[model samples]
Target chain A: MQQSNAPWRTPALIIVAGCLIALLTFGVRAGFGLFLEPMSQDQGWGREVFAFAIALQNLLWGLGQPFAGALADRYGSGRVLALGGLFYGLGVWLMAHAATPWQLQLSAGVLVGLGLAGASFAIALAAMSRAVSEERRSWVLGIGTAAGSLGQFLMVPLGQAFLAAYGWSTALTLLGCGVLLVIPLAGVLKGRAVAGGATSATTREQTLGEALREASGHGGYWYLTSGFFVCGFHVAFIATHLPAYLVDNGIAASTAAWALALVGLFNVIGSYSAGVLGGRYSKKYLLSSLYLTRAVVIAVFVLAPLSTVSVYLFAAAMGLLWLSTVPLTSGLVAQIFGPRYMATLFGIVFLSHQLGAFLGVWLGGYLFDNTGSYALVWWISVALGITSAILHWPIDERRVPRLANAAP
Target chain B: MTGHRHAALLLLAVLAAWSLLLGLALWQLRLNDEQAGKVVVLFPPAWDAQTHFERTLRAGGLVVGQAPLANLWVVYSEQAGFVGRLKDQGAWIAFQPAPFAIVTLGGCFSGPGALPPSFLKTRRLSGDRP
Candidate 1:
């Protein structure tokens, strides 16, 4: 890796700060599901409206990620992260006061979406990847992913407690304040992707256009992107609708809240394990296996009788698979293409993920409103998981010729 | 040495911030328990407006208003044990709406064209309760 000579720019500092940023950003985003019920009930709107807004948020996050990543590549992640934090905080603050669907779309969907693109895990992971050696890179990425899960675990309960005490509006306002902490930590992660013509041990000087074209031409990249779409779909669907589904089935609201928290908590172990294992195994195979396992877990949860025990069991089982794809998929991008433009390239992949998220969340609400049940969405999730497993199995894990030739 | 010290300081600061947030959330939740009178009443999905009205009246509570959800309503009563009465009358779930009043969002009960006079009366009654 290209090491900075500055005393404070140690790899440890970058990794620590980057992990914290990922934690805050992902943690805050994960808690949005807790608001869907209250917001929908208050507005007298169908689930579709809030789902559409959140779906739009995912779409915009995906749409803006490349631009955000490119800017982070050209300038530095710190500025992008700080700007994103401001927009994110404002978006949440505005979402609290949104009286109409359009206002909700603008604040929660557009502003927060764009803000997430700039301050998301993709940016933080890219910076962290460049800070470490290749041997330790995947493990570091896992740690960052784990931190994000930890945030979800901590923040969801906190958000629930806040909602219980202060109400939804005050809860969101307080959460917005929590997101602003990202700005001050941004200072530690200041440096462009190519500092003095080197990044992540690569000295190749490729322009932005070349990087995009090269990646676009690779079949594996497309496969990887498509597979990631399923990941997004499964995540957003469950996060948004699972609590409602449980409530409809006669579970207490507090149990539903704890169920989501359990998903986050268990994911901490799952993500870290996936990261450590990715370093020693085939990333493609690991990803393939993870998707296949997701299908089975969902199938069992839906087929079995609904009880608090089943719900908690399902949460724990699914938690192990949740967000576990992140480290391995990101590792593949860094491995195959080189980490020089990882923020931009991985941002594209993440865009696919967010697009899937958009569809999953929106479709869940639309389907439920029409049929009065989420059964079809669960079946669709199962089918997509199997297909994703197939899509990933054929990906060639080899580096492109350029990266191969440049390797010492 | 300096890098190690800087990293340690950052860790400490982050931990402190998180601890403070957790403490605040817990404390507020505790305080909310003391001021819980107004409750959110949920009925079965098939329940209609008349059913919600009949049920609330049966439970000896005034209907504050309905939320966006067809089966969910904001019910207010100064009568103690009113929540238990709601459960006795087939309410799916009745819990304190303390800080989560659905009507306060303005979409449901804000403008003059919004809720009825009875809703306004009910709101006035429950205003100081929670």
Candidate 2:
């Protein structure tokens, strides 16, 4: 019996690297909401002021992702992470000392958003996916996602503690420093092949514009993009406003923070489980189920008794459904189009997600100011979730036209 | 034939296991019928100028009556006016109807004419003086 060389080792290493990258990127982003109230109170700014900044951060993050992903795909993930770390550090420092709303917008919103785009799992997972075998791709993606969820869990509580002791500005500065830790991990991502083997069949490489046109022409891409938009809206709205909502409802701020943390912790399990399941089941059905579950969970939570227990329950339920979409969504993109320009294509899809995020975060603040209730925002989330569930139902998850023709 | 049948049986077993797991998780989740308790509710005192501003309080499956006259107090901050008054010192509607249940909602209220019948209830009760 011939001993097979440990072929699995490379994939395992790539998964670990992906997980660490995810942890640093999302941990900081998840903790951003914790600063909303404290920073606003200190600066005498309205919730909308900070909300707008975070909304911009989300938008720019979406905008920056494809470019970052392309750069990493072309050059390697090392340089991207290094550059992102610098920007992230600078952004956090500026946020710490920000006196004006515009400064907050620039530092926290634009800079951090772009920094995260460069550093996040979108790029990291693409790199990992390319490095691993097709059989392990979904599992690797899941591990990467679960790492980000773990970051959310760790960072939210840490942010809460920082707010308690050192204040928001100082806490932000320290958190920024923590993001810089990713710089070292980026070294491990060096020297991998940029394009997956499947992507190289076409003689003529499509330019970004041509790629966009090709993707746009495909009905599945639009469905993916539109459904992803709801995911963004639901996540960004809740992340930005739920703490404030809890505070308004007379719940203790710490309890609200814990609610957010619990979401992250449970999502760790949910995302990993979803990834495992995606391997065996139809990815589309799994995605549809996730969205529908989100709608049902949100509707039931809002209608149920509001208490610490309910808050945690809601958080856990929602968390499990949260970002469980990422692995499946990105997995489908790869499944449909191959991983040649996976980063760039996924970035465009993510742009739609960010657009929804922009609306969700901004609209939450706007509506709150106008109506003094989050009822409308909650209902919109439910509607969007249901819509997303339906949108993903009919997507033909087959290889792209060009790829199909070229294959032997 | 044997290999194909074995593969099919394996697939069925996996599916069955997943179904059982999902069903068990769903069954464990308790569905509560009670609606979320409002910790605080804000309304203009003018809305209750005539009638007694009644509010019910509930905690731990126990329902208790609260006399609006005794429990509900009209708070007037100097910072507010006819419109600003409610804006400044709006009524506190307790969602949890308990001491520890945190306040959840705060806002101002405005309407036409004098204070409502509920607001006048306190005055009427005070008016029956000898």
Candidate 3:
């Protein structure tokens, strides 16, 4: 049964706000790749400089997530989200004015990264998960992920138009202002997790340290963490590099832009389906299958001839698997450990994902600069995908003893 | 269940709105294609007026107009492959001017309501004649 500790903080309201937050935060970040070409060209810097800043941004975002989740788990999501929005908006706004590499790193890398940690859809998922009953949690997580993908679908073109019309500086400033919209939405997402609701509550309140210790000892948690790393690597690499790769292969810039957007478009369907299916099936198995599918998809895309049609096809196929892992992976966390410290535990799992992202983005730039192709990195992604698929196969999906004992 | 239904309704509404916006953008692009020989050129933000002017001339284009934003210019050229030339000369993006300018300027000013007067001025300046 769903318990309402705060009648005002209805599940509907939380879901809505969480969805919007996911839209703004993920949408803005997804379009960062659009900046890479123009911004690097304008600054007379190599792709590595811009890539390093973005990689650092991912690293910082991943690093800050657990702490931000801890804070959200402890105090409330509202304050964390508000502060994050401010940082995010300010970071992007400053990034527009950053002339030097160091300045870019400070603004785009540090501030925006931290902003994402707090304001990202993960926090929203956690909040939304706590709002609904156990049966609905997976589906809600899917809704949030799908909304974020929709943001990507919507924002990429808008970002491209902004870049095409106003230039990168004004476009970035506009996006910065857009991120500030998160602050108001955060208000409705206020309140920590309900003390004893559905599968989330323990008979006795567990300390954060104990929660951390318990999660660390769980082998399934480590497997989930390791598997998520591949998701981060694949997504970050493709989102950051695919536009350039497509353009390099004789596709028009406009087509390339739309191809990236198409990924986001298809992702909405994939994420929602994953969410809906995750509720009905074993999340671990779903995760395993999603990874295996990614490996095969990437292998096929790479082996196929590059054309406008192939690019769009690859994007649509890849987008389906893109963030679909998010809901299932996070769902498994909520399922096994419960949603009590989901924000924190998921944050740690997300950290591995970010580490993969950092490597993916940085390595893509470095390899391209040295080898003049993204071919090597593409194969690495495929290998990692296969490895992650294998890792998730043996995970135990049952609820932890503590939560199982507390369950009615 | 009611909450879930409401959330689903909202999600559907969002997807619908996004699809609508995409349709509008594609329609605008098609409309923009009907008018040719004019391209919006985006230069680096750090570039000055002299650089933009010289670059446009170098790319075989005549400077037709400028947007409020510093680095975006409206250029006209009778020469073939004008957009390609602009790309060669380091223009970040070269595209049909109206769709991008109108959408961006409209966005900057909030909406179509605040758009007309500024847009009219831009149109006059952007014209091959004026």
Candidate 4:
């Protein structure tokens, strides 16, 4: 890992700032579902209209990740993050005034999605990795990732209370104000990645073209990318639809909020634990096990009773497994290719995740509207979990030969 | 070294504060879950929830006041379980029942259409002197 000696760019400051960015960005994205029923009811729109808009948001976010990532890799993440924060706040504020689906598509879908691409874990983790030692790398990554869950734990309940007290419009505007904090912190994240040519103890200088071409040709990269799709599918479906699913199953609306909060709370532990384990274990195997465990957890939850106790238990179980995949997946990229091109490489992988998210959220609403059940998408999530489990098992974890030369 | 330590301390302090707020929020939600049964209910002008849900209300609560033209009734339930029982039997549920269930997001609320003039008599927190 490489970093300048600026006081503000120290590992401690980077970790603190990076974690906050991840917390705010990922946290807000996770609770958009709590607004679904209220917003739909207020506008007299069916679930499909809101679901499709969120689906577009997911798709656009995924679409934006690669470009945002490339730019961050070329320049620094500070400006990208600031710009992303501005757009994010703008998007949230616009969502408050949107009367039609088209307005929602522009604000909630396009702008928020694009903004998320800039400030998300993909960039923050990549940048933070450059500030720490290789030995502390995976653990640091986990810390940064866990902050997202912490944010969710903090934000979802607040969102519920706001939506319940004020209308969705006012709640959205307040949340928008919350996002504006990210702009200044982006400056705190000002640090450059050490290119491959820079003399670092264990890093090599690889040009953008070289890194992209190398990654494009690697079979393991494809496997890693493809496997991440299930993660997106599972997370988006649960986040966007779980509140309504709880309401449908005779649980209170607050239970939905509490359930999501439970997922967020437990996820902090899960992500950090996964990080610690990733540092000691093979990332590929850890990923495979995580995916398999998710399939089993979801299957068990489906078979169990839907009472509040059972729902809390399921949220705890799923939360432990939820975004736990993030560290392992990103760590695998750094492990195999080296951290030099991690932002760009991981961004591509995240794109696949977002594509899966699009299908999961849109299809969740579509299927529910047509069939009056989310059972089909639930099954799809289970099947894809198994598929990703199998996909990760064979990914080669060895560093690329060209970049394998000793860092010094 | 002290500067780094101070930075770390500040981060920890911020995190602790956020955790406190978050814990309090969750604690508040769980605590308020029981207290939200306090509400103003208005049935159809000619109808009554107390008389209609008489057996359930008698077992669980007391009707504090009534306004016939407003089609409104203030039912103060000392029992927190009162609302849950009403919800269990699929009784009408509303966020603000006096102004005619303006925002019923959960449970059964008949339908979502314009409330009749008889049910639209709005009230303050101190409603129906009867």
lDDT (Cα, tens digit) per residue for candidate 2, span B77-104: 1221222222223433322222221111
Question: Per-candidate DockQ versus the true complex?
Answer: 0.07, 0.02, 0.05, 0.05
Alpha carbon deviation, residue A395, candidate 2 (Å): 0.4
Clashes of 1: 2
Question: Chain B TM-score of all predictions, in order?
Answer: 0.48, 0.24, 0.54, 0.34
* Model 4 CA RMSD to the hidden true structure, in angstroms: 11.0
Show the lowest summed lDDT stretch of 10 residues, model 2 chain A.
A1-10
TM-score of 4: 0.74
User: Which segments of candidate 3 are over 4 A away from where they belong?
Assistant: A1-5, A36-49, A99-102, A164-169, A197-203, A243-256, A304-308, A365-376, B1-8, B12-36, B39-130
RMSD of each: 10.7, 15.5, 11.5, 11.0
- For residues A1-408, what per-residue lDDT tens digits would candidate 2 score against the true structure? 001123543544555666777876776676675576667788899877987887677667878988987776556666787788778778888999999999999998888888878887887777666666666667667777776776665555455445544567777887788777777766666543433244454713755567667888989899999999898888778866676676566665657656765676677778877777777788888999899999999898788767899888998898888888988999888777776567778877888887887678679879877776888889889999999999999998888787777665
Over B46-102, each residue of candidate 3 has an lDDT whose tens digit, in order, gives: 999899999989987899888536798888887777777777788876666644432
Q: How high is the TM-score of chain A in each model? A: 0.89, 0.86, 0.90, 0.88
lDDT of each: 0.76, 0.65, 0.77, 0.70
Q: Per-residue alpha-carbon lDDT of model 4 for A1-408, expressed as tens digits?
A: 564447756777777888888877766665576677678778888866776776677677778888888888777777788888899889989988889988888998889878888887788898877777666778878877777767666565456556655567987887888787788877877755764343354444567788899998989999999998888788778866666676666665556656766776788888888887888899999999999988988877776766899889988888898878988899889888877778889999988887777677678879877777778778888899999999999998987776566643
Worst 10 residues of 4 chain A by lDDT: A195-204
- Model 1 misplaced stretches (Cα beyond 4 Å): A3-5, A33-52, A96-104, A163-171, A195-203, A246-256, A305-307, A366-375, B1-16, B28-130
The candidate 3 chain B region of ten consecutive residues with least summed lDDT is B104-113
TM-score (all chains, Cα) for each model = 0.75, 0.68, 0.76, 0.74
What CA RMSD would candidate 3 show? 11.5
